[model samples]
Target: MTATEFIKKVFFFEVLQGLALTFKHMVSPAVTRQYPTEKREPVPGSRGLHALVRDTETGKEKCVGCGLCAAMCPSQCIHIYTSEGEDHKKVVDRYEIEVLRCVFCALCVEACPFGAVALSEVFEYSGYTREEFYYTKEMLLENWDKNMAGEKGRIYFEKFWRPKTVDFGAPALVKTEERKTV
Candidate 1:
């Protein structure tokens, strides 16, 4: 072995270097968050909990009982029941999401043509029992209500409502005047 290599091994240079680094970091500002007390802000477009959007004018849910969300769910955790109402409109009889089985892929949000379903930024949901995780329509609506209750909630909702510009490379799908005539 070279003289420098032998000297490094004999002096335990690597161990000393590691210790020096540890001591240096010990004096540095702590990066640890106090969690419950000091919660970090969720980034834009962050998907956490699920919620059902309500119509601003009528104060009614935007969901039209379309099962597109359930159909597009990869995990099949969404359950939606629809029936014809007295007003001749499809009524959402039941809407349930099994949170435990959900993969949080946000497919349901993307599939909802009416922008009814949205993933909220509230990720602190935890329960002692498995049954507690099963969120019903009322529970989901309540979640949305809680989110939209404050100014922060309004900002969050606005972020979701803002039009997003995404380009999916399928020119044939784009409807033009020529295509409309054809």
Candidate 2:
């Protein structure tokens, strides 16, 4: 062995260096937050939980029972059942979500043409039983009302969600005669 390497091994240089690092870290300000007392705010547009949007005019959920959300879901966590109402309109009988199985990919929100579903900024939900995680239509609507009710919901849709197709600016078309051949 080299003399320097033998000296380092005998003097416990590696252990001393590790101890120095530990002490340095101990003296430094703590980066860890006291989670229970000082909970960190969730980032805007962060996918946390699911919610169904309400139509202001109708005062009802905007979901058309089209099943597009169910079809688009990568995890197949969403389920919608439709039935004809008294007026013979197709109404959503049930809109159930298996929260435990959802990947929070937000594909369902993107797939909705009616702007019915949204991912809320609520990340603090917990349950002891699987049944607690199974959300019904009422529960989703309640979430929308409680968390993303007014201006916040509108802002979320405008800022985070994809823009409407009509809002896109199309390029101007050029005449065929004006095009030069390469």
Candidate 3:
């Protein structure tokens, strides 16, 4: 209606301003990473993949099959079956985690009194089928074995944000027995 408004409309002043902003960003530094080639390190307390911790002494699973992790999982993705071992201690018969249903809440990590389970930094595990996502106890243990080959004791757990009193026990001074063979 006004002369100024008419000039702006005819000249497309707002469109020019938007174009200028676009041009500015085009020449600026890229914020996105070149994924696959350059992977970014996961930030502290980032919940990625679940792994079972192995005991230092016997090179066995640290989980006593207390079923705390299964009970705490809000998504109900965790399943555990325990049976009495020859030593009279409760042993984990089966542990399965449906990765597709997991919420990555890290509650399972917090609920384990023995710190047998932890979320790792390996977030790239993807598959075409649902069967690939269903991680059994052996698969989870294999993940831990592969991911934590050279690291000294629970790396992700140490970086995880939690209370000082929440003890996952001391780190193993010696490397796992399996690692020594390789």
Which structure among the candidates has the greatest TM-score? 2
Estimate, for each residue in 47-157, the C-alpha lDDT of model 1 and write its tens digit. 888888776777777788879899999999999998998979899989999999999999887777776787887889898999999999988888888774446444444
lDDT rank order: 2, 3, 1
User: Candidate 2: where is the Cα deviation over 4 Å?
Assistant: 86-88, 163-182
- Ten residues in sequence with the least summed lDDT for candidate 2: 173-182
Using all chains and alpha carbons, the TM-scores for the candidates as numbered come to: 0.77, 0.82, 0.77
lDDT of 3 at 15: 100
lDDT of 2 by residue, 25-101 (tens): 99999999999899987766789899998877898998889898899999999989999988889999899999999
Residues 36-147 of candidate 3 have per-residue lDDT tens digits of 9998876544677888887768788888898988999999999999888787989889999999999999989898877788787788877899999999998888877877
| Clash totals in order | 0, 0, 0
Ranking of all candidate structures by their TM-score, best first: 2, 3, 1
Error of 1 at 97 (Å): 0.8
